[model samples]
Target: MTLGALMLVEYLRKDMVAHGKIGLTMALYSTWNRGSSYPRDKVIGLLGIIEPRNSFKPEYSWTVEKVYRVAMRAAIAEDGNLNCLGLISEKKQSRNKNLASWVPDFELHSEPFRDYITSLSKVLNKWSIYKAFMIPGGSPDITTDEDDSVLILKGFCLDSVSVVGTQAPGPDFESVGETDPELWRSSTRDALNQWRSLLPPNDIYLTGETQAMAFWRTVLVDLNQGRLASKKGGRPKRLDKSDLQDLLQLETTDGMEGLLSTWESCLRPIYRQLRLIEQFNRRFFRTESGYMGLGPPDIQPGDAICLLLGGSVAYALRKSAHETWTYVGECYVHGIMDGEAAVKAVEDKSDFTEYRLV
Candidate 1:
């Protein structure tokens, strides 16, 4: 273990190449899962999954507080050019007067929260979720007091894709309670199977080990936080067959293929319901939007799949504009992140769109 200040030791950087980001993060997550008292942010930081600022001192100096300060600046901008790099989630964002889903304070917005995220997005030109998980290495162009809200780095309008998928930081399962254990299990299986069908052929369908590992880490998080309930020591959150319908971009809901539709039904819900739909499951018959990938729950209907210029991974942005196109929270866009499909979309010029992020 190392101090967060010097997130990456020389040997550790080499080890990261061997383990990869998701593997290393999961290893850290596993430690936290084993009852270690570490916040999620701290864990990710020690993995060097944080953006650096100013001098890259040999000594470990980026304390949790300093990191948080950097994070705060990204989250609530006081001015433009809030230089940052990383990804966030739907649950952690509240830049606008967005309503909270499960808990009010958690997913809701405050002045600090709003300003910080706006600046972060403008600086990084990406938004969607979480306490900014900054990628280490880049230095900030501005310096300010620790407590001061940082200025923006040339803000970009995040015109929400007319379509948005599930709201972030999703609802905690334990709080929501399962309808019935048996039904929940069977239904979840059906949902997974439903999602499976949409994947590429069995021979071709496989997520990178990093992403698959990340999915498990997400499961671990959901399990620990009571978002995925268990029966005895824990209560798993449950949903119904009909509730899972939102997973697909059905014509009825105005689903927008890989991205979300500007339609109301898809964006209106706050993820209180697990509303993904099974393909050819009666729901799609009603809509015009053709079946998309083996739609994943996290990337739900009405979200845009964007292959950012510099990013190796594809992001799911909530389309917020038509003219000067904008989006929020570049998140995990399950099927498209792999690049092959995104390239195909661009090639076909059918499902593809070329939009400027900032």
Candidate 2:
């Protein structure tokens, strides 16, 4: 194996020995021009060791002992490839018009039918285990009778549970303005005025284009210095430029207001890009046919969505009021009930959710 691959194995082995900690979690990996070289960043991330190699500068090869350290930790009892758990990659070449390849270790298995069945069974058992503990989906009888396992095996039915969630706000078009003359005056006066007010006094002599550049330059400088940003807990934080692009490149709001407001004080720099708005649909909003469009695609009935709530908040603003809505249930289904039908069905019939496949 190449140094990169060896490093990956080392890190994965470490994660295995740690019972699923300290390993790269990426489902897909791409090497330059489809190479065998280890990804430098991934190795560092997995091993917590900085493999100092500059893309612009060549470096020495890794030592055998370094690679062995990873291998050693992964050995369950000194003779195995890994001790606690082994991660396998199941990559395959693809001919689809959209994607060229599929990655993710779980997908790499040859017996796809069996693999998916096993995967689904494990997931159901996991929920069943938790349900036995009186958790949200837990039932009292999941661990009860021998016959319960047989009933649950008939086919899992997901239950529909409604949790209160805050509705996301609509697009802030009044702040940004409309696209057409009938709706918008098409005047640059207000935006220009606001831009002028934010300018440093010395920029007065600058032409409009130059002044705009200067204003953005100042914001960029602040961004570089970590000034025009927000921080939470102990880590450094910055606005996600991708989320902003998705908002601009696509016309619809994807409930990303919290992510958008990090650099809200510096909004003009982002809004000035006409191409971003034009490209939003294609980049941010993907159609059902997989075609790109403007703005974030709306959540439709039967669409699979995850529900994630924030752990804490400092504001009552709708966006900050609760955690982001995770896309959990299948998007094509209208209600959570449809997505969880299998679990509910199993519970209804069996009075239990968890069971060992054995």
Candidate 3:
């Protein structure tokens, strides 16, 4: 069976019992492939499934942009968090310029990280490991503009993108029935090399991690083949000393050819993880303050990385006009993923700023 079909069946047996809120239902539905020809069906098609209906109604006359905006507003109101923003992707944003930057286009496919972002189990827990926001019981302090196209959020800009690396190779680089690994190896090697060159040689990040260590960790977004390994009867584990030892060889080797010749077997797992991250269509970047991260494919050197109130992860935003920011997409920055930035802000008495996302 297709993966989407299996996910549907699993949702029917498991998720359906737990998910009754509009936000959760919308997040779940975003993972599925809707076959409707009408654009409004993206939201209208799932009205029957969202239980205890608050204000969502079938309005065929509404524009697709309005439908998406209303659905996003209701989802955020019901959930009381900005988790829905995780579903926004550059691919989806590029499809419809009229849609609000804060509102996600449910019609397009998003990244796998959406599952972790929109998870309800992680909502109430403030002290969870690896969470970006540290404020306890924090909820989104949000408002809308006159036309509701602009979403005003309370948060502080953490850092600005100073350097961005090449876009990772897509799945087609290793096409079906292609046995040769040279093309894939060369492309991946070049990308990693470019990312490595962007950092200062022999310098340590603000988090006190070596540049080499942070580079590998950021490339994989600090995850061990979690979701991919679960299907193969293996539990996901965090990156450990042994994993780092194997990955650090990228620095010692002369090039991809030299690396492959000696430690190919030892680095197999690391390579697999890299391929998976590449499939997500991400780019490796660095902030002005020496923070390394994996951001959306469209992330640029001038983009602002912010931590919005009640957000589980960091976001990449671009300045559009005077004091207005456009949502780039979700991001994974090292060091600050577990609330380090938020804690420091409190200690330093840095006031949170209001961001108007359009």
Candidate 4:
């Protein structure tokens, strides 16, 4: 069995010992890789392990798409949070076009990297780091149509994408054994330079941090300073003054290329963290209001950055029809991640608009 499978087994064992019943959402996420010859088995096979309180039953006649859709809706309703939405793949990575944009494709294992910083598999653990909806007393307000095809949510649009940069190199580019190490470094440096240029000329973001600081933080999803902030009981914090000084040094140096050549010890950790993010398929984008972010690889120029009621992170959404939106994947917008946008909307008395996701 793979390491992930083993970890899942261990987690289930621990859960049985502590809680006596596995959580429906945690069970689904952990067993996502347990595929079978029949696609329906993906959801049905999980029945033996999950809690008896769950309403899922073997529906052999249902199509694979329907099974996944039902499973996703049930998981969200039971969890009372939008964490399951984080598992939805980017548009290009998804295999089932028929499945609703909000539903996760169980067959496609797009995320291979499981480092502490980027992996979303452990739902409870990652929530501490990506708290986009930090406001207290918030809960998911989810409903579905008669056929359960449309997912209705309540949230406000945060911003619209205006500029999108090139996608960072894939995992192949960073494989030292298969490709030249120098080529990998050179390509990454070039990508970083392009992303840096895409930032607006403004020195400071609305969050009051320097452009350089925000750029670095966003690329690493604000987890670069070390794993302490993301520990079990810890909360994500801003990059300190010392971190800013290192970034400023890189800024003054003759571009990223020059700084890479120097190979300074202080800068190595930051670059290492950045490389971790680049290995994942994602793109850097700036919103119309100048907010910077890193999102799914398929994110586009006009996609909407929205903060769903109970989501722990911001999401990228595409308007597919006059009255509905398509879920583009989760994203990391710099300025409004920690509930700043929600606070402002509340102060302004902005109404929570209904988003119908197809």
Q: What's the candidate order when arranged by decreasing lDDT?
A: 4, 3, 1, 2
lDDT of each: 0.29, 0.23, 0.64, 0.68
| Native-to-model Cα distance after best TM-score fit, residue 23 in candidate 3, in Å | 4.9
| Each prediction's number of clashing residue pairs | 60, 48, 0, 0
* Residue range 147-241, candidate 2, lDDT tens digits: 21111111121222222111212222234432333212112222223323533344331223344343332222112222312222112222245
Candidate with best TM-score = 4
Give the TM-score of each candidate.
0.31, 0.20, 0.79, 0.82
lDDT value, candidate 3, whole model: 0.64
Model 3, TM vs. native: 0.79
- With candidate 2 superimposed using the best TM-score fit, by how many Å does residue 49's alpha carbon deviate from the native? 4.4
Badly placed stretches (over 4 Å) of model 4 are 1-10, 13-19, 90-94, 110-126, 134-138, 173-183, 225-242, 252-279
Descending-TM-score candidate ranking = 4, 3, 1, 2
In model 2, where do residues sit more than 4 Å from their true spots?
A: 1-332, 337-343, 351-358
- Angstrom error at residue 175, model 3: 9.8
